[model samples]
Every structure is written in C-alpha cells, then in structure tokens.
Target: MTATARLALTATLCAFAAPALAQEITINSFGGAYEEAHRKCVIDPFTAETGAKVNIVTAYSADAFAQLRAQKDAPQYDVIHFSGGQEIVGASEGLLLPVTEEMVPSLADLYDFAKAGVANGEGPAYQIAAVGLVVAADKVPSEPTKWADLMKPEYAEHLVLTNITNGYGMIGLLMLNQIAGGSGDDIQPGLDAVSQLLDAGAVVVSTSPEIQAEFAQNDAWIAPYASDYAFTLKKAGLDVKFIQGEEGTPASFITANLVAGRDNVELASKFIDKSLSPDAQACFSEALRYTPTNSKTVLTDEVAADVVYGADAAKGLMRFDPRVIEANRSAWTEAFAKTIAR
Candidate 1:
C-alpha cells in the first residue's frame, strides 16, 4: 500500500485501541505508608511502563475478605492484597484465583517458602512483614528482652496490642501463645498472657498509626507488631525499641490475589509480576522497611543488617502453618475478643 494508505490504516487501529488502553485495573492495597510505598514503587512504574491506569482501594485484610464475600457474584476489585493467611480461606472458598509460577515467572525468583502463599494455596507472596514486639524505651522502666517480658510486673497495662480482626493481632496472639507453650491449635495461652495485660488496662490498637499515637502519648509501653511498623514508629520520632523476641518473630506475608473473575487478567498479572520484581521489591524494602521475598532483589548491607533479609534471615523467623491458622482463626478471634473485653 502507498504511504498515505498505511498512515490511514495505523490511525484506524489506534482509534480502535483507545478504549482498551483506557481500561483500568483496580487494586485493594493497604492504606497509609504501605500504600504510599506501593503506589511509588509498584503502581506508578507499572503505569509508566504499560500505560495502564491502576486504581488503588485500601482495606484491612479481614475487611477485604468480607467485601470479597459480599461482592462474590459481582466482584468489585481486580486484585486483592492480603497479609497473614486470609488468602487461604479466600482460595478455599473460590473467592480468589490460584497464583503459581506460570502466573508470575518471578515466582522462581522468590524464597522457596515465599513461592507459596503461607502454604495456603493462594496467590503469590509479594512481600513479608515480620511480626514481633516493639517497646517504648521511655515508658518501660527496663528494656523488654523477650516475648515473656510483656507479662512482667513492670509492663502491665502498658502493652499495646493489635486486635484479632487485624492480621498483626492474629500474629501477636500466636506468638505469645507459642511462647507460653501453646500451638496454632490453642491460642489460649496467648490470650491468657495478653488477658492479664488487658485486665491491667493494656491498649489494643488496630492500625500502625494508632500504635504510634498510643506510644507517643506514653499511654502504651510495648506492642507485639511487625518489624516494619517498629521502624515506622521510630522514624516518626517515638523513643522506641524493636525487640527480635527471644523466641523469634512470625512472618505475616502480604500476598497478591487475583479476583476469581476479573476481566483484566493480563494486566493484573503484569502488575503482580512487577510488584515482585527486583526494582519494586527493593523500593518497598528500603522505603517501607518490609522484608523482601524476592531472592533476586539483593539489599545493601546497611539495609539488610537492619531488617529481615536473605534466606537464612527469613528462615530464622517463626511461621505458623496457614492451614492450621485458617482452621482456628475464627475461634481464636472470638476468644481473644472476650479476653480483652474487660
């Protein structure tokens, strides 16, 4: 065809492509600084790379699950991000799609355990948040040296806890319970331990900002929380200390789940792939202080030294089986709510 004919054909194709290109994929992400890091490190670059518009919707993991169940027949979100093992329950109920090496080739690039979503058979593990205890140096008379330190006479009523409905809250329960000689099947010991604190007036906080606020006012002395949040609290100028827990910390990973029936599978898959990519992983680790699951994303010595990094470091952390946690989470939450009701 002549040059003018070729130009006319290209223009027609471009006109037809406009609508599809204009299509947007919605993602439910964690709000606050985590969301900001995701927007900067993952969403922004993905948009710049593919010209795809991504809309970010924020919800806590449990709330996101509830929303998914309510919108089951007519789903609203394209990709759902979850911490802890909510993905397992979502996957079993067919609310989420499977994420395997095929969906994200970078699956091979992540740690072996990270390849599976908390062993829950859900989507890919994009990032990991190490759950542990954070102590307020100024409030506590002495440094908290172990997980059992919260139950000590000096720290009663000063403990800040995340509630059961939240992911960190669940992890805190499991960690303390395990330290008190309980397993995933029994969170009673954990509850009993924290119940003492609650009885003495320990504060229960559901969000990172809430934890920080409670600490800033010297109302809370210590909290069982993620390592990232400890750094976040410190950076915000709280005189705090992050304890690695004499009994190690639990790993509550953030996973990327595809909505069971979404129109933008290709786009969504691309976004997930990019989220686990080296660049995005590094950005999240450095900026948000999350533990990177992508093995290929090497961190500088300085950054790695401060946070959980590498296969050895990650393995050193504690992990609850997602299936076990899934089975007992509902019951545990009810018991925990009652324990802290005082």
Candidate 2:
C-alpha cells in the first residue's frame, strides 16, 4: 500500500479508539496515607497505561457501602476496594461478583495457602494482606516474639492500639487466643483475650499513622502497628521492627468486587488481573510495604522478613477466614460492643 493509504488506515483506527479511551473509571478505596501510596503506585500508573482515568476517592468501607446502597439506583463507581470481611458481607448481600482465576491470571502467582484455603476459596475470599505488631527497637523487649507479650504488664501503659472494632484488631485478638489456646475457626478464645487486653488498659487510637507517630514521638513506645506503618517508620530511620509473633500474626485480605449496574465485567476482570500481576504486586509490596499475595514474586531480605506471607513467616500467621466471620460478624460485634461498654 502507498504511504498515504497507510496514514488513512491508521487515522481511521485512532478515531475509532478515542471514545473508549475517553471513558474514565472511578475506584472507591479506603482512606489513609497508605491509600495515597496505592494511588501513586497502582491507580495512577494504570491510568497512564490504558488512557482510562482513575479517580481515587477515599472513604471508609462501611460508610462507602452505605452510600453505595443508597445510590443503588445510580451507582457512582465501577470498582470498590475494601477489607476481606466487608467483601464477604457484600457478597452475601448480593452486592458483589464472584471472581475466578481465569479472570485474574495473576492469581496463579499466589501461594497455595493464599489461594486455595479458607481465605481465598473457590469463590468467597478474594485477596490476602497482613496486619502485625510494630515495635520500637529501643522500647519493646526483644521484638515481642508472640501475641501474648502485648498483654504483659511491663508494656501495659505504653501500648497504642488501632481500633479493636476493626477486622485487623480482631485478628490480633484471635492471635492472642491462639497463643492462649484458641483457633481461627473458633474466635471465642480470641474475644476472651481481647477482653483481657482491654482490662489490662490498652489505648485505642483512631488511625495507623497515629499509632506510628505516637511511637516515633516517644509518646508511646509500642503498638499493634499496621504492616504499612512499620515499613514507613523504618524508612524514616526510626529504630523500629515488626514481629510476626511466635503464636501467629494477624492479616486481612483486600478484595475487589464487581459492582452492580455496570456493563464492564470483562474490563473489571482485566483490571483485577493487572493489579495482581507480579509487576504490580512488586510495586505494591515494595512501594506500599504490603506483602503481595502473588507467592512467585520474591521480596528483598528485609521485606521478606517483614512479610507474614513468606514461608517461614506464614507459619507464624493465623489464617483469615472471611466466610466464617461473615456468618457471625453481627453477633461478634454485638458481643464486642457489650464488652467494650463494660
């Protein structure tokens, strides 16, 4: 073909592609400085690649879901990123789409435990991530080898907790119970341990950064730090360390579910796959300090030590089963509220 013929054909293709690229998808995610890191590393790069604009609106999952429910007739977003617990509850209420490995090819990179177990079963549990104890080298005694150490009287007045009401905190409770003879399938022993911690006088903070800052400011010496928080502290030159704990560590999965009233199921699936890719997982793991669910991707020595998903570290982590939690959340929360009020 002539050069002019080639130019005309290319021009025609570009004109046809412009409309699809013009459509921007909005993603609603949980708020925190960590969300900023995700936006920088994940959302923005995705936008730059596909010419699909990504608007990252940060809101707590519970509040966002309430808003979504109210706006059911006119849904505002295409994708929602939230806690594994919330995703399970949302799936039960008929609010989410079941994800398959076919949809997210990156699923193959995850560990067997991360993929096939109770956490990421045939359809329910979507993604896996961790939350563990953050201790200052100067303050905590020997990196608190186990969850039971948090309740030790020596650290009583110095501990900063990040929301016992949250799922991560609940997992911490479960880990304590595991140390005290409780299993994930049976969180009662864990709940009992939480009650004990409260009685021992643990200070509950509003956010993960607050927990990190309190420790860094020397206002408090130790806390149940989010994995992200601990990484940030270490980067800032703080004498900080994360302990996966001998009894076990606590972790929660982040899930992406198909929203109702959307026609882009295939696109959503593609997006999920991209997010779980080794490259993307590496980006999140290194940049955001999250342990990637993709088991094939290796971390740096320091990060591997920090990741609860690593083989050795995995042994120390209490399994997260969202389906079980979904079945009994209300009852557990009610019981927890009652205990807290006392």
**lDDT for every model?**
0.80, 0.66
Tens-digit lDDT string for candidate 1 (229-339): 887787888877666777776888788888877778777878889998988999998896788888888888756754788877777676788778777777887887788
Could you tell me which residue pairs clash in candidate 1? none
Which candidate wins on TM-score? Answer: 1
TM-scores vs. true structure, each candidate: 0.80, 0.76
Report the C-alpha lDDT of model 2 over 181-222, residue by residue, as the tens digit: 766566677667666767787666656566666877745666
Cα deviation at 193, candidate 1, in Å, is 2.2
Clashes of each: 0, 0
Worst 10 residues of 2 by lDDT: 117-126
Model 1, C-alpha of 4: deviation from truth (Å): 25
| Distance from true location, Cα of 265 in model 2, Å | 1.8
